[model samples]
Target: MTNSPKLAVRGLTKRFNDLEALSHIDTEIAAGEFISIVGPSGCGKTTFLRIVAGLEQASSGEIRLDGRPITKPGSDRGFVFQQDNLLPWRTILANAMIGPEIGGFGDKARVQATRQLLKLVGLEGFENYYPKQLSGGMRQRVNLARALAVDPEILLMDEPFSALDAQTREIMQTELMRIWEEGRKTVLFVTHQIDEAVYLSDRVFVFARRPGRLQEVIEINLPRPRSLAIKRTPEFVALVERIWNLIEYEVRQSVLEEMS
Candidate 1:
């Protein structure tokens, strides 16, 4: 909320015994910026995201939110995982209201806030429906609404749409862009999908394989308020191809090392 960048990571490294998952990762994310991290599997994209979310610790270096060191998870940052992870027993409204309820907000206020969020996410009338009752895309919408219910200053997402069908994934992407634009929340998204990364991020952080180091930061110069139409443009295809080449090489190298 201060004038400082919404998030900053410096020399962040993570290790499991001798296996380095991430190394010397550094980046600064401006307030309200949308950034995506992409790389081959095991490159530590999720590890870096988890460290920023305070779900995990780094072997070395630091992460700061508004210039303050991030030591553990807080309400200031919300996370949506690959799975919706909604409580199946709880109705959609109850699920979305959980965070506010835990925060000790009064019932009326929580209900009001949850309703608005459901509406924002296009899940208004479905509030009483259970997670099992909704389609995959609809349930993910609940997941998103719940994350937004907390009104976190930053949203850290790890492949939130990976499980959905291709068509659903595209729809969700469009919905997310609209929600992001409306809320202006700072977002750090992690995914292996190059096209999705190019379409959604203001900048894409291309990472090297294991012991993930940021290999490149490519700016997405496409016009804002974008939709699927932009993905077909020559510029979009070129950027996607550029990133794919980097990742494809790493993926092959990783496979060969494992086989050897």
Candidate 2:
């Protein structure tokens, strides 16, 4: 990491008229770092991400990328949403090529880049397959490849694997770590899974409920190039338990508020 963070989010807040979606979030992401944001539903994890991606304006706050303020969506940031969001008619290869093609990259280069990305995401031979033909995990892999095709400096993924079954989700998580290690793009991932956050992050940001606040930013001391086995280790379990305790109260509070 360098002296400056790759992304800086300062005093970030968001509102929708009567409801404050987020409040006073402050965080910095080092270049090539992988960080996860975990919190209860409606805590603005996605909203925070949108601001960084320049999709939504922050009511009050600043988001800077490489020391430049972010005001609108740009090719510099690649966003992978909860769903694959792939076009039903496009082939996997075609879908992955969308970004580069739209950016006016050369046809041959775009094709080459898309193929390489598909291979990197373990979807090499499936390039010709349609979205409907793929399993949930495979479609998400396509989503990732498409996001990476843009060659963004930063990748923001919002629960990209949330729709997969347990087994497939685990597999995709491993694939993601491998891809991240290979690509080395700065990543800000938002998810609700405690174990998922802990397993994949260099640091985990815990957020409180609605009108979200940054509750804690815990650095993961675990070794890198991590394997799923680490989740069973005493150290990993302890870390998960610690985060669970931190978020559990917020979860209950949100539930009570909803009920009332």
Candidate 3:
């Protein structure tokens, strides 16, 4: 990690008219770090991510990348939504090239790079396939390749695996780890799955119920090059349990508040 943070969130807050979605979110993400945000439902986890992606506006405060204020979305940040959002008519290669195309830099070099990224994401042979022709997992792989096509500085993923089946989700988690290890891009992933968060994160940012606040940031002490087997280890299980306990408590508190 560098002496300076890769991304910084300061006093961030968001509101939807009468409802406040996020409250006073503050944190720093170092370069090449993988961070996960987890919290109870409606805790503004996705809202926070969208704000950082410049898809949603924050009611107050700011997000900075490399010391520059991030008031709008730019190529510096790549986002993977819960849904793959691939154009059904477009081939996988074409979909992956969407970023470069939109940026008006879709030259032969960009095409070669996109092909490389497609292979990196394990979609080399499927480049000609349409979205409907691929499996859910494969489609998501295309989504990832599309995001990486732009070579963004930071990757913002909002439950990118949440739509997949349990088995496919696990597979994608391992795939994501492999891709992340290769590039070590600064990533901010949001998920409701505690185990997923534990497995993929360098640190897990636990949030309180809505209006969400940063409750704690727990560092994962396990060694890297993590595999699915690590999820079975005592150390990994303990981390998952710890995060689960925190989120469970928040969920209970939210329920009690609603009941009251």
Candidate 4:
């Protein structure tokens, strides 16, 4: 962990043929900072994160990790996709150990690390269960554990809780906050949920549609260990309202442009 940003994006742009997914994206995710990107569908939030993870090539611009150019995928960044994407054949513990195994860690150390992560995510007793044996939320917990197995310096998540029930999503959000605070890991999260973004992020980046330009950045002044009670606070509501007002206009503009 460097004193500077663990991940930095400078004028990052991504285009697919004539469709520009991200344009001039500039953001810095400092070490141990929890940053969330919120935008409407097709706003290119996903594309932006994918570029950072080196899953998609950007048309121009550059990404750096601790001042070093990021040109390909490696263990420096861990990604948890929208779907849990667990392996059905493997047990939860086995799935969680995959990253460490692939990275050539010793068996005992990987098992110990995976067990600790699973415990942190509240799946301690279910380590032997397969993916199909677990619920959506449980599978997601496994997904999170797997990502942390290699101890990556950064975590890039793309709406990893969007598919769960409201209750499950709430639980997972709290769990995510716990995991983040415990490890102080740098995170770049993407989601369409305004409340989710506001609750989880130290700073929230809003994106405009079509080409996905930076709209506004909101600082979450809420205190740490934010529980559901904080979400009901006047301060939380105010933040959510402000973010919605900023993005609503952009979303309408995007819709109109598509129609036109």
Candidate lDDT values, in order: 0.90, 0.90, 0.90, 0.88
- Candidate 1 per-residue lDDT, tens place, 51-158, comes to 988989888999999989999988888889999999989999999987777777647877898899899989989999999999999998998998888889999999
lDDT of 1: 0.90
Measured against the true structure, the TM-scores of the candidates, in listed sequence, are 0.95, 0.96, 0.95, 0.94
TM-score of 4: 0.94
lDDT of 2 by residue, 81-103 (tens): 99889999999999888888778
Residue-wise C-alpha lDDT for candidate 4, range 1-260, written one tens digit per residue: 24677777889888888988888987777888899998777889888877778888779999998888887888888999999888889899989988888888848967987898999999989989889989999999899989998899999999999999999999999999989989999899998799999999999998887677887889998998888889999999999999999899877777787799
Cα error, candidate 1, residue 51 (Å): 0.8
For candidate 1, what is the TM-score? 0.95
Which has the better lDDT: candidate 3, or candidate 4? 3
Which ranges in model 4 have alpha carbons more than 4 Å from their true place?
1-3, 252-260
The Cα error of candidate 1 at residue 209, in Å, is 1.9
